[model samples]
Target: MSIIQQMNSKLANMIAAGEVVDRPASVVKELVENSIDAKATNIMIEVIDMGMGSIIVTDNGMGMDFLDAHLAFDRHATSKIMDESDLGHIMTLGFRGEALAAIASVSKVTLKTRQENTEGIEVIYHGGIFVKDGTSTLNQGTVVEISDLFYNTPARFKYIKSDLAERQAIIDIFDRLALAHPNIRLTLVMDNKTIKSTYGTNDFYSLIDQIYGSKMTNGMTIFEQTVQKIHITGYLLSPQIARSRKKDISVFVNGRYIKNYKLVQAVIDGYHSFMMVGKYPIALIHLEIDPSLLDVNVHPQKYEVKFVNESILAYYIETYVKEALLKQTHQIPETLKNISKGLDETYIPLNLNFGEAVISESKPVYETQNTEKTPKLPDLEFVGIFSGTYILFQNEEGLYLMDQHAAAERIRYEHYFNSLAHPNPAVKHLLFPHHLQLTSDDISVISNHPKKMNAVGFYFNEQNDLVGLPIWLNDSEVEIAIEAMVSMIVEKDAIDLAILRDKLAKDISCKGAIKANKALSLSEINSIVKNLRACENPYTCPHGRPTLIKLSHHDIERMFKRVV
Candidate 1:
């Protein structure tokens, strides 16, 4: 007898289950994809016993007949692909035909399906064995109930994550699928509570509003870019609305969700200089390309894909997203109709002397202190300050409110950043060499990186005390600046000179900028505004809070009911 023998069907199925049904989320993914492939307009997923106990997926789609339903549990039985040639051009979300079989092998499965013009049938399976069959009077759709996941395989069941973790995985998959298929009415319920739901409006903006909330609509813009037959379309959020994680960033290819780091990076790179450190913007990117140009069969779970023309895809995505962001900057945002309802502009308290303001029932106006305007200053005429924090101005385009502190920070950050980048540091000899005390770790870091200290214009004495300092910094500020750079290295526990220099610049700028509640004269405010306009990215501070907010005159009129 030959040493090698073919594995039995049950054994083969159990082996395949390792790939298809790793946890509750994997089973949900396979079944949901099957429903999507069946042309389902509406789908509902219900998780019970925190995902380890059971899962139910119901769909209003063209169901399978009795024979096809039975074969659905058999290995290598599929109606998606006919032969080998169909592999290159895969259109459906699922085609492997192993999901149902592999899933059934590990759990108790009950499937009830009724196709059009056919009687309904209910089939049950336990641990990959055909248990029984029954007749049912059901609608023309499918209902799949999977219970006791990993029951037959205790080893695999032990590796499953906690209930909360498993529930999160299921929610993640459901969100991805719902985002990918905005036209489908998707609902998800966990432990008797509906967790997620979307209408079948075929409008992605509406879907986003439903999921993230209506206020998020203010921070996002839609864009569509085409190259020949391929089309890239989606919504990209403003940098101000970015979050710390890339969790909100989603990518879809021809209505199928995928995980592609290069594509995600391309979207991030589009923000370029506008983004803050370690932050990612909200992006929902959809790419419509020829199915022949992509390979969706690369991954067992069908979440990863290989593209034939990824470079071209990345180029268009980066280019169009940048263009969209630029366009958004120039366009006026839609105004809320009742924005100024409770705000009384005419009321000026008796004790207040808010610079050069003439309050009237019609409209309030403020005169600028400087009659002669310079080119560097913005064309906007100066209005009074609001609460001593924001400087108000009016131009032909709109009403502008500049946060004094944030504006000054942007100007200061650029100044220090440029000086640090091009280190022509002017040094000053100390009248009395200051003795510096530091922790052993800081001393070791300084000792290891003598060149970094010299590059930042710090010269030490024989005892590692501060002897000389940068001329741009005052004697009083030297200790603070040096400590900032040293503490940054110590905190990170690393020695990247470039990052240390940048952090030092940012810290110095933030410390030196003017703070809120400090009274500023009209000329001082104008000077800050002029310097802010000269900055490369004046819209936001180094920490990414917007420096200014604009309210268009049209928006003001709408709020006052002057415009219908």
Candidate 2:
């Protein structure tokens, strides 16, 4: 007998399952994509025992006819594409046609489907083999129920993750699919309880709010930008509510969620100066590009894609995100931060609290949208300084408490940031020569970018000593400013002024700002408040920390139970 022989269809499909159906989430993703490709406006996915026990997907989409109802279970059988020419321009989500076959190879499947004004049919398959076919009395659409997954291939169970892990994985996938198509009403149920729901509402932000939970969209802003052939819409949350993980940054391409690190990083880079180190913002980027420039067939599961010019696309995304964020003014939200961050890591209990997100067969809550923006700071009267940290201020609307250190940082940061970007600057003559102490590495890093240093108004002498300082720099902070500039140059490992400016601004602002537990005279306190109000983004420091918080008179009364 020949050592190498053709494998049977059952074995082939089972082997293909290794790639297409790695976990319960994989099954959910494939089934949901199929439903979406079927033009299903409403889809429901139900799972039991973390999907190891059973999985059912029902959709009110265009169902297959009697012939396709049976053939859909065959490997490589597809109605999505007719010939090889269609491979280059795949618009449907299930073009490969291996999902049903691979899913059936290791489990028992029952499929009921019907077309408009046609008789319904039900088909059964076990281990990729057809067992029986019968007439069905179901409505227009298709229903797929999978039981005993990986039953034939018992060893596959060993590769499965834990129950909680699998549940999160399934929910993550469901979230992505629902996020990609907001016009479709999608629901996910686990153990008879609804996990998520969206009701064919085209309001992207409301859908995002529904999926992510109430108050999650508190600091988010939406904007759209278009290139020659590509248009990107961004929904970016403020850096004040930054998260520690990359999972919250979602990117979609033509209604398909894809994984592209370069693009995700671009979104982060746009927030270079706004966010603290090690923190990331939650955002959704939708890239609508010509299909001819996109290659989605790169990854086996189609999670990643190849763009014609990935770098250019990333640049646009970063620029647009930065512009959108810069256009908005923010104030410290007194109740939003503590409540939002206090929730569980994963979204939950939203169906009860969010009347706008989760709903029944009624009118959309966001049908008439009410817009809200972070209000501008009002002119405040200096009450007093408390603990040498918080400066108290009051206006007719509310009471304001400002962090003296953070407020100072924001004021100085804008000054240095603008000075660095200026083409021409005035250098301040030092009354006495200030000697600079720098390691050889620091000198070398600064030496490589002499022009950049001069452009920012920091020049060094032949002995590696400072000659003069920028007019914007206070004489008291001469040594500290040079040290800050050098550290940024070394940390960034390059002389790029655009990147160096932000780092230097952060370092200089924080290092020179007044410290806590220090005394400030009434005049000094008023000066700080006046300067802070002049800043472009006075609400936050350079490192994205809130500089001020508001407490309404009603809030104080409620806290004391006097308002009730």
Candidate 3:
């Protein structure tokens, strides 16, 4: 007998099930994705015992005819694709044709479907065997019911997670699918009770509120950016609502949920100065790209995708995210908004002395609903410093308190960032060869990508010794800058000059900013205020700390007995 024997169709399907329907959530994902591809505007998913006991999916979508209804359980049977060219342009979610077969092989399945101009039909399958077929008096749609998951293959049940874990996993899939297609109404029912529901509507803001909470939309903002053919729409929540895990940082490409580290990191990078340490913002980034530019067949579950020119796409996403955050900076440090809202801004409190009026010559960028490009800062009269820290000022709209150190950091960060971006390299000879001792791993990393340092205007000899300095870097900060660069490269093997430049800028600016409890001359105050006002984003420093806050004139009156 030949050692290599072809497995039976049922055995083959059971093998394939290991990849497609490994968990309750995977089965739910496939069934729901099919409904989405079928042009379903309404989908309902009901699961019992965390989907191990039974799983039911009903959709008001284009139903399969008698032929497709039967073949749907056969391996490699699909309506999504036909030939090789179809692979390049895969707009549908379930193209592989493996899900139904794989799922049916492991469990009992009942499918009832009725296509247009066709009579209703029902079919049943047990462990990949066609048990029966019959007529049905059903509506014009499809309903698939799966029961006794992993019943035939009892060994697979050992890998099943706890009921709570499986339930949460299914819920995560529901959330992803709901977000991907907000126009579709999706409901999840577990153990005879409704868990989540999204009413079919185009109002994504409302949909998000339904999924997250009623007040979620309050902290979230929408932003749009387009470059060439690629368009991205980002819904970024304020950092205050950020979660500990990167799970909430979801990304969708061509309306399909995908896992792209570069794209997700781009959004995080855009939130660089706006996010506190050890926290990731809750963000939903959707990318609309030409199907030809995307390779969706890379993963079995179709979560990981490859995009041509992904770096360019990431760059645009990062830039626009930063732009949107800068435009909405006043909303951060949240206490400022909580105090001002529903309060009378028209009232000017009594018994308060605001010092001499200081008019800023340059405009400052403040939060506004206006479409104009230039951001405007409030007009304030300079008041004396408080507690040797806050730079106080008063305007008709409110009382302004500026964190002097934070303001300086923002100003200097922008300065260094701009210089790094446009390096006007005035190379000078070093008094001594600036030598950097590197570990073997560091040397290997440097040798692997020798251009990363040189691109930033740091030249090294064969021994990895720095020989020249860029004019933008001061002599005093040379050791600090070089040490930081080597550490970054050694730790993560960072190769991008842009990222390196940003890291250097953040570090250098923090080191150079003025310390607190120090008095300033009148001219120094004017200069600091002027430079800060001119910055692209002056509301927060590189570390996401607020540089200034505003308290309206009415806030003062409410504090005293002047007004209630």
Across 189-306, the per-residue lDDT of candidate 1 in tens digits comes to: 8888787789988887777766654445665778987786788896886565534457668899988989988888888888764554455677899988888888899877888999
Worst 10 residues of 2 by lDDT: 346-355
| Global Cα RMSD, each model | 19.5, 24.2, 21.1
TM-score of 1: 0.61
Following a full C-alpha superposition, what root-mean-square deviation does model 3 have from the true structure? Answer: 21.1
Rank candidates by lDDT, best first: 3, 2, 1
> Stretches of candidate 3 above 4 Å error?
334-564
| CA lDDT of every candidate | 0.73, 0.74, 0.75
Clashing pairs in 3: 364-376, 364-377, 365-375
Per-model TM values vs. the true structure: 0.61, 0.61, 0.61
Off by over 4 Å in 2: 331-564
